[model samples]
Target: MKIMNPSLDISWTHCGDGDDARYGKSVKRKVDRVESDGRKVLLDTNDSAFDFIPTAEPSPGTIEDK
Candidate 1:
């Protein structure tokens, strides 16, 4: 999935390496942003993996901006 904002861009993809016994599936995330000098900065370009858990909805009384 990809998320874009006025000054930031974020994306992630599944690693397909299978799920862990405790942490769920594997995923890779990248974050990029535009600097004030009109340069694009790669905030995260590493191959690190993160655990992802699927959620159906937010907890009760969750406040959302959008």
Candidate 2:
């Protein structure tokens, strides 16, 4: 997922292998901690393992009518 703010220090990058790109891997870390390039995002931490996806929407969350 792309960082909402470029100024954010969060580290991330594309997968190395093509096959690996289909799915995602998770890393155990604090939200405030510095992330690495290969670490998958935390979609649901409550699962047996941290769940994640390859990509995500730009402005996360629903767009309600004003």
List the candidates' TM-scores in order. Answer: 0.22, 0.18
Cα error, residue 64 of model 1, in Å, equals 23
lDDT of 1 at 36: 81
RMSD of 1: 11.7
lDDT of 1 at 13: 36
Superposition TM-score, candidate 1 onto the true structure:
0.22
With a 3 Å backbone cut-off (N, CA, C), the pairs that clash in candidate 1 are: none
- Candidate 2 per-residue lDDT, tens place, 1-66, comes to 554553443334332346645354432232322247744333334332223222332233432111
lDDT of 1 by residue, 30-62 (tens): 235556886554434332222222222333533
RMSD of each: 11.7, 14.2
**Residue 62 displacement in candidate 2 (angstroms):** 30
- Count of steric clashes across candidates, in order: 0, 0
Predictions in order: lDDT: 0.36, 0.34
Report the Cα lDDT for residue 36, model 2. 75
